[model samples]
Target: MAVKTVEDLFLHELSDTYSAEKQMTRSLPQMARAAADPQLAQAFLDHLEETRGQVERIDEMVEILNLKLKRIKCAAMEGLVEEGKDLIDEIDKGPVLDVALIGAAQKVEHYEIASYTTLIALATKLGYTPVLPLLQASLAEEKATDDKLGKLGQAAAIEEAVQA
Candidate 1:
């Protein structure tokens, strides 16, 4: 996984993204369970399924592109998941907790969005057109999930404030 060429960089990014998505599948269920709001819980669950699909797409890209991803863990995603777990442990269960969860979820979404964006750019540069649709689909889901979390977070924050 030496960074000798653009293709090497692309493969590294793709591998990182794949690891991120896999980490997400395990973390999302915990986030869902910790969510005070049923809607927020469902959102986490829904995204969990999407994350699984995303992993599959990455697997497809590996086969199509004949990529050999190194056995690397995405440290950024691990840190993000740890933060979410911290919130779940420290925060009391209620609207405030719900708001916190939304924030945590948004952080994950933002990271994924950045990962996918970079992957898309790299793929385009490498002329890896076959994998473009898969990457684009995942990016779309990440952005849409972020938008949903934003709305949910806003409402939850207002509710928490009024309650406070």
Candidate 2:
């Protein structure tokens, strides 16, 4: 796709995020299973559900915009997920692994935050009024998930990992 206009970029990004959310849904279950901490596991599970909802929102946006429902594979998310799989395979299941998982998960959340922020800004500029709310909803969820992971890391995962 050639860079012609902001609308083109917005569609490109929307497709990218749609793919990322789909990838997360697939990877998150494995992440939950790999977590040593129950809380961390539950967070992954909860986010899996949220990711599903985000996917639906993306679909709605596509329908509203009358855009083709095509997903551009987000290479960044693919790399992040591969790194997570490497962490799971290399690390022994324990506090250290849990902390590592939190770090990996936070990285994913941060990526999502940045992606959504850009999409929301583009949507607003494009006068995509109906799509703005959906983008904002997903952005809010991503930020909340990042905050939760940070609290979990500070409260327990970090200390336990350091001791281990």
Candidate 3:
């Protein structure tokens, strides 16, 4: 648990990411249900599936590295998820809520992007060649999800919400 080596840091990050993905898997359904926009709702559902896959990939990496999955709570993700839940509770279900949801979701995506970026670099430095592909795959998905959210924000949904 001490910050002794790169391997230790890698394991800590892996556990954090695993916890984040698991939290997302549980949170996405609520987000999807709260979304009034069909596209936004569907996006959350789609990302839920992607998050599940990401979790599996992390499990595979842990297995490959011969490391046991630790229950290290991702505090960042926990706070983000709580903020999202608060957003959902405070706002009425509508385009405005959808826009707010998109904002919340994008924050989650950005956190993931940063986490995976660090993870991929660390993996490469540690000679985790086989794990690179899995990390890269998740990175690409997170980027794509962020882009999708950006597009959703630019769509008429947010404008309508602002006017409403």
Give me the runs in candidate 2 sitting further than 4 Å from their true place.
none
Writing each residue's lDDT as its tens digit, candidate 3 over 88-117 gives: 999999999999999999999999999999
36-154: candidate 2 lDDT, tens digit per residue: 89999999999999999999999999999998755479999999999999999999999998999999999999999999999999988999998898999999999999999999999
Q: Would you estimate the TM-scores of all the predictions?
A: 0.96, 0.97, 0.98
Top candidate (TM-score): 3
- Of 1 and 3, which scores higher on TM-score? 3
lDDT against the true structure, per candidate, is 0.91, 0.93, 0.95
Q: Mind giving the per-residue lDDT tens digits that candidate 1 earns over 62-140?
A: 9999988877899999999999999999988778878888888899999999999999999999999999999999999
State in Å the error of residue 132, model 2. 0.8
Which candidate has the highest lDDT of all? 3
Question: Cα miss at 86, model 2 (Å)?
Answer: 0.6
What is the number of backbone collisions in each predicted candidate, taken in the order shown?
0, 0, 0
Candidate 2 global TM-score:
0.97
